[model samples]
Target: MKRLPGHGLRRGQAVTVTVDGEPTAAYLGESVAVALMAHGDLSTRATKGGENRGLFCGMGVCFDCVAVVDGVPGTRACVTWVRDGMVIERQDGPGARRAAPGG
Candidate 1:
């Protein structure tokens, strides 16, 4: 989806977050999904059938926006607020796993 200029309400302090190793601009109070979608990133994970999925409910009810954030797996981007220096990665599937800490 193409986002228009001056979309949504005014945002808070601007910050940088990494999505799949690429830095993107984000706001402090907005959800990670919102920030990513603003950058034209609609897919956050792939289904078991290899189908891409993204935000659905925009609320925490739906798990479609799940992604690996800050080294943690199964994080819902819709409810998780963006933080500076956050590292988010797209999930391969619903059961995607992250590498062992310090491994």
Candidate 2:
């Protein structure tokens, strides 16, 4: 999804987050999903058969945006905030719960 224009928006402090080891620009208080999407990372996790899924429903209700952050599995990117130096990884198979470093 395209980022909305900055009009009528108030962003927080500047911060840098790492997605799959790649440094990405972000802002404090922004959701990890937003941070990932802002950096062109739309896929967050893989389901059965290696089908990737991403931010769906946006809110915490849908778990499609779940990923790995700071070594924690099943972290809902849409609800988790991004912090400076935060490390995010794309989740592999949900059953395996393995995290891989890449887009």
Candidate 3:
């Protein structure tokens, strides 16, 4: 795992969070939502009616935790990691959408 240099997090303030199934280098300096949104992943999940969902609330009070981050299901996108190899995908529901052939 690659470490990202930041000063806001104290020696005992930093914590590592994984997104999807990939390892992410993140700090506890900011909200988990902001960190994940910064990854350029505009769409975190597809609604039941097939609508795209993004960061609406910066707080962890929302139900946007429908994603699977690090094998944990229902993880909130707005409250997650910010780094490389964070395996994010448009969550279909409790289960994941099967990838298209050769995708």
Candidate 4:
């Protein structure tokens, strides 16, 4: 497969992002981290203890690869390719963050 070229996405590159119900388009060849960051969604997942986490390690070494993409859990945005009409959501935390309160 061929790469889309880094960050070169224009209005017609064929990518979309929906964060917390809001939608936005993304350029091809751009990392999911870069796309979300562009829309101010730096914290792709919430930590178990209520801490915000995103792309700390650009490499695929971090469990921080927990991004909800198109209804799937634990998708690595930093390495995943941007597709058309993709929906992204921040993981609550390591333990789902909801039971902890104030998350």
Best by lDDT: 2
The order by descending lDDT is: 2, 1, 4, 3
lDDT (Cα, tens digit) per residue for candidate 2, span 1-103:
3568866877899998888778888999899998877878688888877888999988889898888898888899999999999998878867344454452
User: Any runs in candidate 1 off by more than 4 Å, and if so which?
Assistant: 1-8, 95-103
lDDT of 4 by residue, 1-103 (tens): 2558896745547577776567877777777787778777687787667777889788767868577777777788799877777777767765341222243
- Please provide, for model 3 over 54-77, each residue's C-alpha lDDT reduced to its tens digit, 9 standing for 90 to 100: 667656677764565545557776
Better of 1 and 2 by TM-score: 2
Ranking by TM-score: 2, 1, 4, 3
User: For residues 1-103, what per-residue lDDT tens digits would candidate 1 score against the true structure?
Assistant: 3578878866699999987767998989999898768777698877878788899999989899998899887899899999999988878776574233364
Q: Candidate 2: deviation at residue 98, Å? A: 6.7
lDDT of 4 at 29: 77
- The residue pairs that clash in candidate 2, if any, are none
Model 2 misplaced stretches (Cα beyond 4 Å): 1-6, 95-103
Question: How does candidate 1 score on lDDT?
Answer: 0.82
